[model samples]
Every structure is written in structure tokens, then in C-alpha cells.
Target: MNTILIIANLLVLFTFIIHTFGGDKNLKAIEPEQDSPKRLRIFWTMSRGAFHIVSIDFLFATIGLALINFTDYFQESKLLLNLLALYFLGYGIAFLLTLIISKKFSNIYFKMWQWLLMLVIAGLIYWGNS
Candidate 1:
């Protein structure tokens, strides 16, 4: 269970690193047409803001999971681990509710991946406590 959590955290860390470093390039690939400069600026700001939130959250999760697994290496904070789990569960539920209400997604693949991630976090938190 610990190993699983470690692996999950590593994957999330990798994802955050990719998004934080390659945000511009990745966003460029999916850039949508805008009618005016103002619209484009708004779109970019929203996109980057979203990316920043996800990246920062994942960064915290990665660190928290790492500390949970290797308590001696870093200051282990049960509160942090619990908070991370709650964050995962909340985001997962939010995603599910959003899909249920709208039946639409900016990226279906990412949504599915998030579900898997939520499950892993849930598993880790449940088993870690037991």
C-alpha cells in the first residue's frame, strides 16, 4: 500500500512538473480562436490560473505522500496527509458532479484519469490508517 501511494505520488509529481514547465507549449497546442485580443487574454489568464491551481495542489500532494511514506526523511504531518486525501476526494466528487450535470468535458481522457487518481488516493488513505 505504501509503495502504491509512492508510485501514485510520483506520477502526479511528474504530471505537475510537465504542466508547470510546458504550460505554454501545451496550451498553444490547444489554443482556441478568439475574436479579439481581450478575449484571448482572458482565455489565457483563465487557462493559466487553472493550471497553476492544479499544479500547486499536486505539488503539495506529492510532498505529503512522500513524507507519509518516508517519515524519517521529512517531517511527517498527519494533518497534511489527511488534507491531501480530502482534497482528492473533493475534487473527484466535483468532477463527477460536473460531468453528471453538464455531460461535457474539456478533455474526457483527463477526467477519466482523475477518477483513477482519486481512487488511488482513497485507497492509500484508507489502507494507511488501517
Candidate 2:
């Protein structure tokens, strides 16, 4: 078994759990007031959808990585593995770029540190495949 991929799978699963349950409260906190403008309400609805969309992505990644590590189902699917690696790499890069562009460099490593996890998972997937 690829131990590194297994670790990556576990991390993805953990992230899914946290991003789902733990994030729900934060999601609720963003709800627009009933008296808010129509555009604000619509934006809130779209934002909520986008938040759950990410949860779904994490769920799928967890299942995909689990299958790849625990079974022979994807033994011949190098392209799939590479694609997953690239997906996480893009996630990490986008996250870092957002932080940079936002000019939030003070204590950047600890604040909104999900990018670190993303990069670590990407690295593990690539290294395991290699």
C-alpha cells in the first residue's frame, strides 16, 4: 500500500469533516438579514451554495483517495492520480495567491492556514506516485 497516499486520504477526510460541521456555524454567521437588500440576499444564497460545493469536492476527493490507497480499483489510473495532485496544487496556489493579493502577510502562516494543508496533501500525492 502507498502509505503517503493513505496519509493524504486521511487528511482529506479530516478536512472534509471539519469543513462540513465546523464550518456550518461560520456559514450561518454569514446569513443576510431579512431586511437586507435583494442583491445581498442573493449573494448570500450563492455563497452558501459555493460553500457546500467545496464540501462536496472534499467528500469526493476523500473517497477517491481512499479507493486508490485501499484497493486495486485505480491501480492503472495514473492520470487520475496526477489530476488529483494537480487539483490540490492549484487549490494551494490559489489560496496563497489570494492571501498575497489581499496583503494579509501579518501572521500569514497561522491565519487561514488551509493552504498549508492543501500543499502538504498535494506533495504527499505526488511523492507517493513517484
Error of 2 at 74 (Å): 2.2
Q: In model 1, which runs have C-alpha deviations exceeding 4 angstroms?
A: 18-24, 32-37, 73-76, 103-111
Query: Which candidate number has the best lDDT?
Result: 2
Write model 1 residue lDDT over 30-94, tens digit each, in one string: 67666557778788879878878888887877877777777765554556666666777787777
Candidate 1 has a TM-score of 0.69
- The TM-scores, one per candidate, come to 0.69, 0.91
Candidate 2 structure quality by residue, lDDT tens digits, 1-130: 8888889999999999999988877988988899999999999899888888989999999999888887878757577788999999999999888887886667986788999999999998898889
lDDT of 2: 0.89
For candidate 2, the TM-score is 0.91
